[model samples]
Target: MFKSFAAKAIVPPALAVTGFVIVCCLLLYSVIKTDMLNDTIRHETNLADTIIKSTRYAMLKDDREMLRNIIGNIGQQKGVEQVRIFNKKGVVAFSAHHAEVNTIVDKKAPGCIACHAGPVAATSMGRMEQARRFIDARGRSIIAITAPVYNEPECFAAPCHVHTAEQKVLGILDIGLSEEPLQRTLATLRMRMTVFCLMILALTVGGVSALLQRNVLMPIRELWEYVSRTRRGETGLKAPVYRDEIGELARSFQEMAAKLKSRDDDREGGSDPPADR
Candidate 1:
């Protein structure tokens, strides 16, 4: 009897709660992961912009030492992997990592180079600056931010300033940042979310199981015991009572048992005598 009550009352609610928790957890994890990835991308892009502005000022002043120092500082910053400066002629003038210094990077490279090289497109090279990402030799995991190094009229004159919008490229600043750190951060968040979701599911299942046992299983078991007693010829068996659906069901069972007992007794006492005798 107890087993029957547990089967009907405990299993369904437990299963329902478990399934709900699992679905909720999966949804939350997906949302958190997407948000984290976007946040990391925005942070890295902002860092690139800051570095570009600082290096631009140094370059305009013709401060090679200061420019090198600034580039080195940017490279040391978290998420920054490498930094390179290109002159208007598409020649690598300075690099944070020594391996790239004096190496000529193709002006036709992806990102800003696609438009910044050859003749300066009016739309591409405005008074403001632009930034983008491209793959380096290592892979397509590098971000390349570029800003044109214009010769300030007060600082550079004549030949250096002669280059106009129609002239050949003057210079570009490129900064490359590693994507590993961002990915790692996102992975950690997903793992944590998974763990938290599991914990919630376990708690929900346990709570549902307990509620079912108390409210449904226990009362049903008591009612079953009453019916069994009456079946074994016990008189005046007391039916289990309650205030909700379980109580109403117990009352109906008690009424049915009384009618069956009455019918059995009438047959045994020969309430209808056989016609032949």
Candidate 2:
């Protein structure tokens, strides 16, 4: 009984379910992971662009206070872990929540020299900002955005400080955000999608199994029983009724059984077999 039940009720459905689930999970995992990676890239890029734009506006207006305020505001934004402002001379002019404000930044920090002082610095020196992930002083993973500040030519005419294009190194802004929050969000989304995909696979396999049993297995079993009864010399055996392929099969079985019965009856009475025979 156990073997039969396993064959009839477990194996086919289980195989179908297992195969479907494996494929669905693999596909869903790939798609979800790609989506999360893309989202992270897009979020980081936008965050860097936002910081650069804000910094540029502040520098254009020559409002140091506004620039400080803008950096602070960005640090408060979701996923923003830190914000640092650097003077043209590579001094840390302002830093939000960082104790090292007013100290000169180490040019050895990742991407600092490449973006602020290296040969590629011209295209990178102004207008655009670069972003990267790094470990902070606390050893926490963080995303940092670096943007350069340029001094306008018009400012050079002022007696206070000459700001020609050649001497226009104004400053750099660095924004950092903890990676934990982004990681958590992506992990949650992956879990949710995996659960959802499994649920869908379960339902699909269950529904298909139920349909196969009702529309195919049950009818075939009934037809087999009718044939067995006829083979046992039982007269007037009735085939099971159905409304699909099973129904047509049952009708054919009934016709064959009836003909055999008629032939047997004729032989018992000593009459010649039917002409077709």
Q: Which candidate should be chosen as best, given lDDT against the real structure?
A: 2
Tens-place lDDT per residue, model 1, 85-202, is 7775567778878777888776565665557466754334432235455566776466445655554454445443445545434666666667676567767877876787677667
Candidate 2, residues 69-157, lDDT tens digits: the string is 87777778876777787776667877776577778877767857655475544534322336566787788888666755555665555
Q: What residue pairs clash in candidate 2, if any at all? A: 81-177, 82-176, 88-170, 156-163
Worst 10-residue lDDT window for candidate 1 reads 122-131
Model 1's alpha-carbon lDDT is 0.67
**Overall lDDT per candidate, in order of appearance:** 0.67, 0.70
Task: Please give each candidate's TM-score.
Answer: 0.67, 0.67
Model 2 gets an lDDT of 0.70
